[model samples]
Target: MRTAYRVETVRAAESALMARLPEGTLMNRAAAGLAAACAELLRPGLGRRTVARVVLLVGGGDNGGDALFAGARLARRGIGVNALLLAPDRAHPAGLAALRAAGGRGLAVADIAPGALTTLLGRASMVVDGITGIGGRGGLRPVAAELAERVTASGAPVIAVDLPSGVDADTGEVRGPVLPATLTVTFGTLKPGLLVDPARQHAGDVRLVDIGLRPLLPVEPDVAALTPAEVAALLPRPTGESDKYRRGVLGVAAGSARYPGAAVLTVGGALRGGVGAVRYAGPAHAAVIARHPETLVSPGTPAEAGRVQAWVAGPGLGDHPEAERVVNEVLAADVPLLLDADALRGLDPARVRARSAPTLLTPHAGEAAALLGVARERVESSRLTSVRELAERFGATVLLKGSTTLVADPAGPVLVNETGTPWLATAGSGDVLSGLAGGLLAAGLAARDAGAVAAHLHGLAGHAAPMPATASGVTDALPTAWQSLTG
Candidate 1:
């Protein structure tokens, strides 16, 4: 699993590590890695020693020190190096001296003319952004912003030190103009901004440099993405001694006469998911039978759907008396339940909170907004915070679906799904996801694991299918996704 920590946590870890190290040990190790990374970005013809010129946007703190020291290393190797200091008065004295001694040119950013800056930036092989450190908040200074604009206009590949300036290291918010790097060389550990969206978009490719601070970091990280091996271990496999009943049964209450295709799609996902049998209870029996002949169809509501290890409710179920009854019956059951789509509308937040059984709420931005009584825009802007709030409020595992699928519970690190393409944003995708996750729940996984694993597999299936894959295609690829984990 890949873990990300907040800015404060990173700072605390850095402080603890620096106390035991020699004065220049950490900075030297960081500079070596940064220089090596920048050199790799310089392609075929532009030789590092003879032709490449790496421009460093030096600021006033540790980030600037990193850039200056890296510039010194490159200068010693005969590469042309120029350090443009945004705050010359406050620049690290030791760093500046080292760069000059190694034949690197140093200049004040304010002193450079537009024509000169543009000309210089245009000829550069690569740009290193060190205008701000993790502790600095908000956007870049005016002079620094202008230099960034010049570099952007130049169309040169940029290597950012630590993180791209102007991004919130803790929240991944980019409110003002900031330099976007083609590659970012971060030190010690990964920051939250490098993983989450908005800021993540600006951080093109990230490479972590070991300043040897891992032992100093806290045991619990803020956010994480599950590894395939971990997911493989979490998944349950049937033994020869296990029967159909032992493998588990998933009960589904979904679809209406208005949208019968939803029931077929939901059942398609459940059948391919790791479950022994699927007991489907809805108004779309004919459609369900036509698609999946093996489904155990119920003549009445889910209340009379017989025994099930877990229940998946909602997805295209229209607002009506019967649909409400199905939702209420499932909620009252002691078995684990997954609520999605139209079921969200029928649920009372108070009742959902009072449920003793494991409940998982899968909602898109709109449904989540309605439940929280906040605007969809607010939820989109702060996805991490919004998911946590939803989980705490409902006292259930909440999966917020988007470009980045996030599953949050009342405790532990929020799991982010780092898979899927924009193509997965199709009709009825959520229905397939709800069924897949529900099946995992029936297979004995907890609410959080079910949601995260379902999302991860759902995304992989989308990619495994042909380009421009539909909801049905994603469902068809479920077996391939599961095999990828097992095999």
Candidate 2:
């Protein structure tokens, strides 16, 4: 699993590590890694000495010092190096001296003409962004923002030191214009902004440079993502001694005459969720049977449905007369339950909180907004806090599904799903994910594990599907996704 720490936690760890190391050790380590990565980005032909130019956007803090030192390293290799200092008077003295001694030149941004700066940026082979560090809050200053825009216009591949500027390191929130990186070389450990969305979207690909801080960091991380191997180990596999009952049965209550396809899709995903049997109770019996003849279908409410280890309620009930009854019955069931789509409407927090079994609520940003009585925009902008608030309010595991799916329990580190494409945002996709995660719950995984694993597999299946993938396409790719992990 990959873990991410908040800015404060990382700072604490860095402080402890620096106390024991030599004065320049940490900065040297960061600079070395940054220079190596920048050199690798130069194309083969341009890599010849004196042919490639690397421009560093130098600020006033340690962040700029790191870039200056890295410029010196590249200068020693005979590559043309130039530093554009945002705060010429406050630049790191030692680092600036080192760069000059190694034949690299530093120019103050204030002194350069706009046209000249644009031309300089345009001619550069690569740009290193060191304008801000992890402690930076809000957006860049006006001059810095203008420079970043010019950098973007230049079309040079940018390598961000630590993380892209103008993004919240702790919440993954972007307040203003940001310099998007082609690659981000972070030091010591991963930051939350490098993993979560909005900020993550700007952070391109992230590479961590370990500087011996892991041992000094805290045991608990603020956020995490499951690796393929970890997901494989959590997946259910049948033993020789196992029977259909032993493998587990999932009960699904979904669909209406108006939207029978929802039932078919949900059952289709459940069948591939490592569960031995699926007992479906809904009005779409024929439609489900036509698609999956093996499903145990009943045209009745969830209460009348026979025994099940877990239940998935609400996909396309669409305010039918019995929809409320079905939700109430499922909530009363002794087995674990997954609530989604139409079933999530007018949900009672106390009823869910009182359940003896686990309850998982999967909501898109819009539904999550309704649940929390907030605007959809608020939930989207602050997903980390919103998910946690929902989890604490309902006392259940909440999965906020989007480009980056997040699973948050009432406590413990929140898990983020890193695997997925924009193509997964299709109609009826949530129904499929509801059934898949419900089946995992029936297979004996905890609410958090079920949601995280289901999201991971759901994302892989999205990738396995062809471009312009549909909801049914994602469902059909489930088996292939399973095999890629288990095979």
Candidate 3:
């Protein structure tokens, strides 16, 4: 797992590291790493004698100091480096002196004309953005904002010092215009903003500049990006003594007369997800059996769907009162359950918390907003917090799906799914995810692991599917995804 530390935690770690190291040692290390990365980007064409023209958008904090020192290194390598200081007076004194000594020129943001700035930005091969850091609030000041706007319009490759300007390092929220960087050289630790969406979109490629803060860190991590090795470790492996029943049974309560296809798709996802058996109990039994002959169709309610290790409730159930009734029964079953689609509406936050079994709630932004009694925009702006709040309120594992799918348990670390393609945004995708997660739960995985594993597999399946197709395409690609995982 790739862990992301909070901004405050990163700050504390940095402070601790600085205290142990000699003065200017941390900044020098950061600058050295930054310069090396930039040089790598310019290799073959632009050799050791750096003839490339570089532009730096310097801000006030140590972030600007990082850029200025890097600029000095570039200048020493024969690169023509220019620093556009946004806060000239507040800029790091040591960084400024280093840049001047190394033949790097500095100018105030107001000193450059609009056309001149645009022309220079367009001509430059790389632009280093140090306009803000994790300590910044809101958007950039007018002058810095204008510079960013121009730089963006120029279409030049940008290297963000710590994170993209205008992006909240802690929350991944982008309030105003931000300079989209081709690469982001972050120091000490990975911030949550670089891993989450909106802000992630701006951080093109992330590179960590190690300043020896690992020993000073407290705790492990709150959020993490699952790697292949981590996902493999979490996946359930069959044993020689295990029978079909021993592997696990997944009870699927989905589909209705109005949306029978949802049942088939959900069952497909469950079967593909390696569940031992899929017991289908819903109004669309015929449709499900027709599509998947392997699924055991039952005519009874969810409670009477026989003994199931886990239950997947409410995919395409519509607004039927019976769907709500099924959800309530599943909640009372004392078996792990994955609640999705129409089932989400049936849940009363207070009642959901009363359940004895572990519950995993999968909700899109709109559904999450309803659960939280807040606007969808609010949920989107702070997805991490919103998902955590949902988990806490309902006493369940919550998987808030979107560009960045976040899975949070009531009292555990949050897992952010970052491998999904935009094509997975199609209809019925969530149904597939619900079924897959339920299948994992039936296989005896923890609620959080089940949800996160399913999300990871679903994302890989989406990526494996043909582009410009429906979510059904992603469902069809599940076999390949599974093969890639197990193979």
Candidate 4:
């Protein structure tokens, strides 16, 4: 798993490490990593090793110090380095001296003629962004923002010295104009901004640079990204002695006459996921059987869907009274539950709190807005806060889906999955996700783990499918996705 911490946590760790080391040691480590990464980018293919041109956008803080020192390293290796100081008067004197000693030239932002900065940026192979870090507020300062805009328009590859400028290190919020980097060489620990969205989107590719502060850090991460191997470890594998009942049964209550396809898609997702047996109950039995001959379709209510280890409800079924009845009945059952789609309608927060079994709620922005009694825009603007609020309010695991899908539990660490392509936004995709999550839950995973693992698998399936998989195509791709994991 790739872990990320809040900026304050990183700062504390950095301070502790700095106290033990000699002066400027941490900065040197950061500079050395940055210079090495830049060198790799410069030497793409064959050719004689000659001087490569690089431009550094220098700011007023230690962030600028990092860039200046890195520029010196590049200069010493036969690379032409130029530092365009945004705050020339407040530039790091020692770092500037080091750059000059290594045959690097410094230019004030004012020294560059009109349009010259863009011209120079266009010719350079890479640009180093050192405009702001954890000390930044709001957005880029006017001069800095303008320079970033010009450089970005130049279409040159950018390597951010630390965290990208104008991005909130703590919240991953981007309030103003920000320069997007092709790669970001972060120092110490990963910042929350590099993992969460808006800012995460701007952070093209993230590379962590250890500055010898690992021992001083806390274990609880602000954010985490799960890899395939880590996800595989969490999955349930059946033993030779395990029977169908021992493996666990997943009860699915979805679909209605109005949207029978929802039921088919949900069951399709569950059957293809790693569940032992799937029992379906609802008005869409015929449709379910038609799409998935393997499904054991029964004419019963959700409560009568036999003994299931877990139950998934609320895809389609509209706002019908019977659908609400099904939701109420399932909540009273002994098994864990995953609620989605129309099942979220008219949901009383108090009722959700009274449930005994672990419950996982999956809601798109609009559905989450209805549950929170807030505007959809509000939920979208602050997804992390919204997901947390939903989890606390409903007393359940909440998975808020979008560009950066967030899964939060009342008592566990929040997880954000950033693996899906935009093509996964097709219709019935969410139903498949709901079923996959329910399958994991039935397989004895915790509600939080079930939601996260299902999301990760769903994304991988979408990526594995033939380019631009339709909703049906995503369902078809689930078997491959599951096999890839089990194998």
Candidate 5:
């Protein structure tokens, strides 16, 4: 699992490690890693014929120190290194001295003309953003924001130190202007912002730099993403002794005459979700049967549907008058249940909380916002907070679907899914995801694992699908995604 810690946790671990080492040891380790990454980025362009130029955007605190030290290292390598000091008074004193000794130049941003700064940035091979560290919050200050704008205008590929300045290290919230990076070199361990969205989009590609702080860090991460190996371990595989019934049966209650395609897509996803049998119960049985004859289709409600290991409710059962009754019947069933799409409408928290069986909820940001009585914009901006709140409020596992899908249980670390492409945003995709997760639930994965694993596979399918992937295309690609993981 790729894990992330909060800023405070990372800081504590850093302090613990620093106490055991020499004064400058930790900074040197960070600087060395930063310089190495920068050098590697510059290598392809610098074919012995071209001279490499590096510009560091240095701010206050240890962040500035890291850039200055890294600049010194580049200067020693015969690379032209210049530092733009955002805070001349607060720049790391020793680090600045070292840069000067190594023939690196430092110019305060205040003293530089706008046109001259633009020219310098345009000529630079790479820009190192060390403007703010984890401690800095609420976005960049005015002077720094202007500089960031200029740097972006230059179109230089940037390598951020730790994280892009202006993004919240703990919350992943970008309140004001942010300097997006081509790559981010984070020290010690990953931060929540690096893994979560809004802030994640700004962080192009993330590289973790281990500075001997792992051993000192806490065992539990604030957030985590499942690696392929870990996901494979969690996936259910049938043994020789396993029969159709022994493997598991998933009951799906979805679709209406108005939107029967939802049922077809949902059933398609369930069939590839490692389940033995898919028992589909709803109004769209004929449509589902036509598409997937293997499905045990029934026109009756979910309760009348034969014994099932788990149930998936909602997904386009739009105002059929009996839709609520079907949802209630599925909710009342003593089996693991996943709620999605139309089934999530007017959902009662009390009903979900009272359920004896495990409950999982998959809601897009708008649905999530409605459930939490918050604005959709709020949920989108603060994804982590919104998902966690929904999980806690409903007392159920929540899979909030977006650019970075998050699966969170009532408690414990939230799981972030990074496998998906933006193309997964096509319509009826959530229905496919709902059926996929429901099948996992039937296959005996815990609510959290089922939701997370389903998201992982769903994302992979999105990638495996043809470009401009449709919901049906994603469903068709599930087997390929499954094999890619299990293989």
Candidate 6:
């Protein structure tokens, strides 16, 4: 799993490591990693060529020191290195001395003219952004922001020291001008900003520089993304004695005459989710069976559908009286339940809290906004806070779907899944996710695991499908996605 901690946690670990080691040991280790990454980007073993130029945007803090020291290392290697000290007098004294001794030329930001800076930037092979570290907040200062913007437009591959400047280290919020990095070389543990969006958009490919701090860091991270290997461990395989019944049965209550395809798509996801049987309870039986003949279509309500290990309610079931009745029946059941789509509408907080069984709620930003009685923009802007509040208030695991799929319960860290493609924004895709999550619940995964795992699998399936894939394509790719993860 790829995990991320807040800035303070990373700082504490660094302090403890620095106290035991030599004064410059940690800094040298960090500088070495930064230089290596920059080297790989600039000169990747070609024919005889002229020396590449590297520009370091040096600031006033340790972040600037890291870049300056790394610049010294590059200068020693016969590369042309120059540093633009943003805070000339305040820049790390030791770092500046190191760079000067190793033959790196630098100019303070105050002394450089706009035309000179632009001309210098246009010829760079790579840019090392040590302008601000994780400790910097809100956005870059005006002068620094303008320089960042210019360099970003220069087309040079920028390697961020820790994270991209101007992004919130704890929450991935980006404001004002920020340099979107081509790569970020982070020290110690990954920061939350490097993983979550809209800052994730700024932080491109990430490479971690382990300064012997992983063991010293906190056990629980604020955010985590499951790796393929970790996800594979969570999947169930059939033993010799396994049967459809033993594998587990999932009940899907979805669709209406007005939107029968929701039922078809929802069951499509469940069938491919490795369930023993999919007992579908909805008015779209004929439409569902046309696509999937194996489904045992119910002739009555969910309670009459008979035995099911867990239940999935609401995809396109509208806000009719019958829909409420179906929702209440499923909500009141002893088995685990996943609520999605229209099921999230007018949900009673008391009914959700009363359920002793595991419950998962999947909502897009708009639905989450409605549930929380807040603006849609509010939920989108602060998804982490919004999702957590929704889970705590409703007393159920909440999965907030967006560019990053996040699963949060009342406790522990939030799981962020980045496996999705832009094509997943199509219609009925969420129905597939809801069904897959429900199927996992039926297969005995907890609410949080089911939701997070389903999201991961669903995104992988979407990515595996053809570009601009339909919901049906995503469903068809499920078995492939499952095998890919398992393998």
- Stretches of candidate 1 off by over 4 Å are 43-50
Q: Considering lDDT, where higher is better, how would the candidates rank from best to worst?
A: 5, 2, 6, 1, 3, 4
Tens-digit lDDT track for model 6 on 150-170? 898788888999999888889
Model 1: which ten-residue window has the lowest total lDDT? 41-50
Local distance difference test, each candidate: 0.88, 0.91, 0.86, 0.86, 0.93, 0.89
Residue 284 of model 4, lDDT score: 94
Q: Which digits, one per residue and each the tens of the lDDT, describe model 4 over residues 178-276?
A: 889999999888877787777888989989898887787788787777778878888878899988778889999999999999999898888765779
Enumerate residue pairs that collide in model 2.
none
Q: What are the per-model C-alpha RMSD values against the true structure? A: 1.8, 1.4, 1.8, 2.0, 1.2, 1.7
**Can you list the residue pairs that collide in candidate 6?**
none
> How badly does each model clash, as a count of residue pairs?
0, 0, 0, 0, 0, 0
lDDT for 400 (candidate 6): 96
Reference-based TM-score of each model = 0.96, 0.98, 0.97, 0.96, 0.98, 0.97
Model 2 Cα lDDT, one tens digit per residue, 17-39: 89999898999999999988888
Better of 1 and 4 by TM-score: 1
Evaluation by lDDT, superior candidate among 4 and 5 = 5
Model 3 misplaced stretches (Cα beyond 4 Å): 44-51
lDDT (10s digit) by residue, model 3, range 71-160? 999999888888999989999889989999999999887888978888778778788998898887777778888888888887777889
- Per-residue lDDT of 215 in model 6: 89
Q: After superposition, how far is residue 401 of candidate 4 from its true place, in Å?
A: 1.1
Among all candidates shown, the one with the greatest TM-score: 5
Query: Which scores higher on lDDT, 4 or 6?
Result: 6
